[model samples]
Target: MKFLIAFLAVVAVALAGPIDERGAQIVKYTNDHQGISGYNVEVETSNGIRTIEQAELRNLGNDNAAIVVRGSYSYTGDDGQVYTVNYIADENGFQPEAAHLPRA
Candidate 1:
């Protein structure tokens, strides 16, 4: 029983150190002046294709972040439509507004 307890304690300590370091790195990155970061994705559908482009800018000092996204859905035989949205995230939460969202 003693040997098992000692082994578990050692394992716990080793795991805790790495977790702390990773958490610190995450905090630092979120607080730094990083340029826009995002990705683009494309998908194919039976009727047509869809593409999405998104980017985000972070202002950790102000505890705020901004995001912009644009997407398009094209039909195989019909003209496609594109939509755009802007978002701001702060301590409160994420607030999004559509710049060119289609209405049903």
Candidate 2:
């Protein structure tokens, strides 16, 4: 019984470390977009297709996500369209539209 408990404790610590690391990654991504206000891109992955919206992005500083500027992107061409966009992060930052971002 003692051995089982010790093994469980070790397993819990191992699992906890990864969770903290993932949480830190999320914070890094969120902080990377801080104070951004105006026309910005949003990236998301879905079951059917990936999505990128050219909406006004605002850094609300909340964990959920950076705020999307309300009602400002209704007429934008890429406003509501869904696409197979892949959001790749590099040394520069989050590249929602890989094609549009200039190659370094």
Candidate 3:
């Protein structure tokens, strides 16, 4: 049992790969008055880092553009289990804390 536990621990650590303590966070500055309206953006926020996956361009209204962001973050929670956090661009702005705002 001891050997098995040790092996499993090593395997888990190896699979985790460096353990990204700092996750990803993305912020989008969208202009809804442009040719694109439905802009899709991907963002991931976890641990202490932020990652931007992909940003899509779309047109929802006349000469308007909205930024749509999507992404995922991986981190080890307090329970010692790997957890993934899914995030999206709520609104379009460069505010310091605009990412947490509610989306329309």
Candidate 4:
């Protein structure tokens, strides 16, 4: 009875942690192939703030991967523009497009 209780406790503890399969794959690819696989950031300043809500890495096979980031930013200024951007990074480099990117 005591052994059974201890085993159940250990199993419950193990199940309490979140599992991230995609993140594990990204780490594996990064370490094995020296590839850029993921990104996450959030920053705030007096004038502006930005947050990266989701960033993921997709394996394209052949040791290649693609990084996709979804984020939003706001500026506390006269324009007071707020918008979201989706970015992709791969062999071609980073490509980011924003629906409300400020134009000069």
Best by TM-score: 4
Best by lDDT: 4
TM-score of each: 0.31, 0.24, 0.35, 0.37
Tens digits of per-residue lDDT for model 2, 1-104: 99999999999989655222222221111112334554434432222222333334444466545544321111112344433334544334565533434677
Backbone clashes, each candidate? 0, 0, 27, 0
Q: After superposition, how far is residue 19 of candidate 2 from its true place, in Å?
A: 4.4
How would you encode candidate 3's per-residue C-alpha lDDT over 1-104 as one tens digit per residue? 99999999999989876655445344433233333334333333444333434445546554665666555545455667665555556456432223334666
The weakest ten consecutive residues by lDDT in model 3 span 28-37
Candidate 1's displacement at residue 30, Å, is: 26
Q: Candidate 4: where are CA atoms >4 Å away?
A: 1-37, 60-64, 80-104
After superposing candidate 2 on the true structure, give the runs of residues whose Cα lies further than 4 Å from its correct spot.
19-42, 45-52, 55-104
C-alpha lDDT (0 to 100) for residue 45 of candidate 2: 22
Error of 2 at 95 (Å): 16
Position 59, candidate 3: lDDT: 62
Better of 1 and 3 by lDDT: 3
For candidate 4, give the lDDT. 0.54
- Tens-place lDDT per residue, model 4, 1-104, is 99999999999999775453344221111112234655556555432444444466777555776665555544343454455566655557766777665544
* Candidates' C-alpha lDDT: 0.46, 0.39, 0.51, 0.54
Superposing every Cα of model 1 onto the true structure, what RMSD results?
17.8
